[model samples]
Target chain A: MKIKVLAFGKIADILPQQEWEMDGVVTTGMLRGQLEAKYPDLKGLRYLIAVDKKIANDDSPLEDRSEVALLPPFSGG
Target chain B: MEKQTVNTEEKPSHRRKKVFVEGPISPAFVGDSIAKHSTMMNIGAHSIFLGQVRKDVIEGQEVVAIEYSAYTEMAEEKFHEIREDTFAKYPLTCMHIYHSLGKVDAGEICLFVFTSAIHRREAIDACNEVVERIKQEVPVWGKEIFDNDQYVWKENK
Candidate 1:
């Protein structure tokens, strides 16, 4: 399975690319592990995963085609 | 782009509506909205909240602009939920929430929240609640761009 990822805020700057893909990821927790492992700099940043337009829990099951976003703390009004 | 009319009939109550603008929310646009609402005789009071990007000196660097980004879909859903919650809690005649995406310079408007009601208290309370809800719940982020290209992440208080 492959998942699409979108990065925002400091997380976007740390990541090499804003939008990309990862293969063999089936859950939010796995993706987090893979991202932190591949991009060690991401480990220093605090963020959350939003899967297919909603906040995702650590063990949230993911669809192969779902869009995942790495979001830092909100600052909107 | 040509001005678009508000088509409230298009979306069902459960469906989320769009609340994003490309850059800054202009004063003329907001004024036009106010002028349009004059036709609604039932709405006696209108309270609005406008968030402007401030130029703050942080560690001797002056902030110049803010680049906003979001978990787009999730933010929309959150906005819709806030709208519904506000309506249920207050006697609002109508509500409009708009936030800026992309770069907005200091002194420009970044967020526009408008709520109309039959009384002043209801309108003011709903507007305050909606603004706070958006700042706390929405998945939108802002990058503070400072002088000479230096930047910092902005966290709303």
Candidate 2:
């Protein structure tokens, strides 16, 4: 299935594009592995995976058209 | 009566209020917001929180401003969730939250939180909780811009 990924904060600095689509990813863990492998800088960076606007664990299932975002430590307010 | 209760319980989260401002929140705006609530006669107390950007010296560099950005779609969701939770936990008459989206200079207001209730404790506690949740949960980022044109990512401590 294809999923959309959005990057924010420090993670955005490493992503080639802030928003992009990836295919053949089955779970959040797989997605993270692929991203870190592609962008070595991501390996050491701390972030959370939010699937469809909700924070998801690594084993969370990814459906087609899921909106995945990489969120670094929040510093708002 | 059953349906009405359900409606009231669910409505707060469903209503998507605008929470992001393009730049720093103005004093006049905050004043107007407080003034507008005067019409609500039942509110006896109101707690307000204003967040200001600080001019911090880092590595001999001075921070001149902070540029904020967010995963807006997710942030709105998180804000709503926080609102719903607070409303459930407190008997607040009203609540409002606003955050700056772009560059905010040192000493400028970056976030505004207001909560009103029949008494002071609920209002004060709700305002504090909302502010804390926004700092730790919302997907908003602030990039500290130094006077030398360099920048660094900010993290909640």
Candidate 3:
């Protein structure tokens, strides 16, 4: 399966592209592992995974065309 | 013409108001917003929250400004949720929220939350709840820029 990945905040700095496509990721857990392996800097960062605009746990299932966002800690007032 | 007037009057409660501005929110704009509410005679109280960018020195470096960004789609959804939840929890007559994008200088306003109700308790409590939820739930991020051009991501405390 393929998914759309969106990166934000400090995570964007670690990931080369802010928005991109990824393949063969079926769950949020898989995506996290692949991302950390590909971008070592991501391993130490604190972030949350939002799938389809809702925060998702690592075991959350994903589908094709799903939009996944890596959100850093929120600071807005 | 009659239908249009009805729609105009009813849209505020139904439509999602635009919540993002390109830069700092000016005081004049805030004043204009308050002025527009004069015709809402039933509103007996209005609670307002303004968030200003503060200059904090870190590692001996003086902060100059903050550039904010967001996952806009998610942020909008979160804002809508907060609005709905607040309305359900309090007897508010109206609510307005705005947050800044791009660069905002120190002492400039970045967030504005206004809540109105028939009584002071509801409006004040609703406003406080909305602001608290915004800080914790919204996906907006602020990049604190230092005077030397260094920057760091701000995290909610």
lDDT of 2 by residue, B79-138 (tens): 989998999999988888888998999999999998989999999999999999999999
Ranking by lDDT: 2, 3, 1
Top candidate (TM-score): 3
Pairs in clash, predicted candidate 2: none
What tier of docking accuracy does candidate 3 attain? high
What TM-score does chain B of candidate 2 reach? 0.91
lDDT of model 3, residue B91: 85
Q: Output the lDDT of residue A14, model 3.
A: 83
Of 2 and 3, the candidate ahead on TM-score is: 3
lDDT of 1 by residue, B37-109 (tens): 8778888999999999999999999999998888777888899999998888998888888899989999999
What's model 3's TM-score?
Answer: 0.94
Work out how many backbone clashes candidate 2 has.
0
lDDT of each: 0.86, 0.89, 0.88
After the best TM-score superposition of candidate 2, give how far the Cα of residue B72 lies from its true spot, in angstroms: 0.5
Per-residue alpha-carbon lDDT of model 3 for B1-157, expressed as tens digits?
1111111142236567678888888888788778778888898999999999998988888879999999999999899899988888898888888888889999999999988899999999999999999999999999999987889999999
* Fnat for each model: 0.94, 0.96, 0.92
Q: What lDDT, from 0 to 1, does candidate 3 have?
A: 0.88
Answer with 2 or 3, whichever has the higher DockQ: 3
Question: After TM-score superposition, what is the CA distance of residue B126 in candidate 2 from its true location, in Å?
Answer: 0.5
- Comparing candidate 1 with candidate 2, which one achieves the higher DockQ? 2
